[model samples]
Target: MAIVKVDNLSVQFAAKGGIKTAVAGASFALEQGETFSLIGASGCGKSTILRVLAGLQRDWKGDVELMGNRITAGKRFQGALRREVQMVFQDPYASLHPNHTIWRTLAEPLKIHGESEIEARVAEALEQVGLPSEAAKRYPHQLSGGQRQRVAIARALLLRPKILLLDEPTSALDMSVQAEILNLLNRLKQLHGMTYLLVSHDADVIAHMSDRAAFMANGVIERSFDRAALVNGEHRMAHA
Candidate 1:
């Protein structure tokens, strides 16, 4: 069964002139352990779709399913749904709490879920993302761009989620750092047997990370590319 399925999904926002349809009848599915991506220009509703699936945007229309369970609009994720899906945003600086220490930030989630061995888990999470255990005592601002993103990734994985919603996760970093984070993400995804739904504007990143990709314009998916097409740089032409 597909890990995620969205059929005829639509999202609208109130605007001065009228209702702005940010996502219009978009549809897609992700298989287990697949890295499926959505690539497009800015304002094409790529991130909006991620928000809906992440349960951050509840007012949407369509049929959606995750891990074989149907999701209802306007409802917060519950039970396994809350624990099984996670998201990593484009900017680590914005996503992390500057006032919180890394240990506090990483330990809070485990505590909320009533998990034991909080200290060990937090340290293990840091190690999993290639960060030293001592880094946990530092704040978000103390870390470099790549380190911050690694923290974000560690936090997302702490829940042991089955699917990760990646919203342009590497676009905010330097070119060299971007490659490192992407490689790390790929490695973690493979090691954990998790599925990914990534959104990015870079064709090269898509080519490197995705098994399949969809191109969007004006809030609609215009086309799709398979692994072969991506490897052959076919999507680059259309993206260009």
Candidate 2:
């Protein structure tokens, strides 16, 4: 069975005396261990789609199903379904708490989910992201941009999510740090057998890492590409 499925999903918002559609009807499915990337220009509703899948924005019309269970838009998704789907935002600095140490930040999710052995898992999660155990003692300001982002990735992985929603995860980092984060994401996917739903505007980033690439324009999917077509840039979709 597909781990995640979105059928005829659409999202709209109330603008100045008019309703604007942020995401038009779109449909897709993700299987186990698959990396599907959505690439598009700004205002193309990429983040809006991720928000719908993450259950952060519920004011929408669609059937979002995970493991055969339907998800209600804009509602607080709970239970195992919530844990199975996790998101890593683009900004690590804003995502991490300035007051909390790395250990506390990473352990917060497990604590919220009532997962035991938080300490042990925090250690393991850090190691998985190539961060040292000593990193637990530092605050967000103490680390570099790359290190902070890795910590954000580690925090998401601490939940051991079945499907990861990454929204331009490496966009804010330097080129060198971007490569490191990409490598870490690729490695972690293999190690945990997790499916990834990555959203980015960079074609090269999407082409190099994703097993399949889907282009979004004006709130709709223009095309989907396989591995070979992505590398060759020979797909029918408009490259944003």
lDDT of 2 at 154: 94
Residue 16 lDDT in candidate 1: 95
Error of 2 at 132 (Å): 1.3
For all candidates in order, the CA lDDT equals 0.95, 0.88
lDDT of 2: 0.88
Clashing pairs in 1: none
Q: Largest TM-score belongs to which candidate?
A: 1
lDDT of 1 by residue, 88-205 (tens): 9999999999999999999999999999999999999999999999999999999999999999999999999999999999999999999999999999998999999999888899
Q: How does each model score on TM-score?
A: 0.99, 0.95
What's the C-alpha lDDT at position 2 in model 1? 97
Candidate 1, residue 186: Cα displacement in angstroms equals 0.9
Residue 238's lDDT in candidate 1: 81
- Clashes in model 2: which pairs? 57-74, 58-73, 58-74
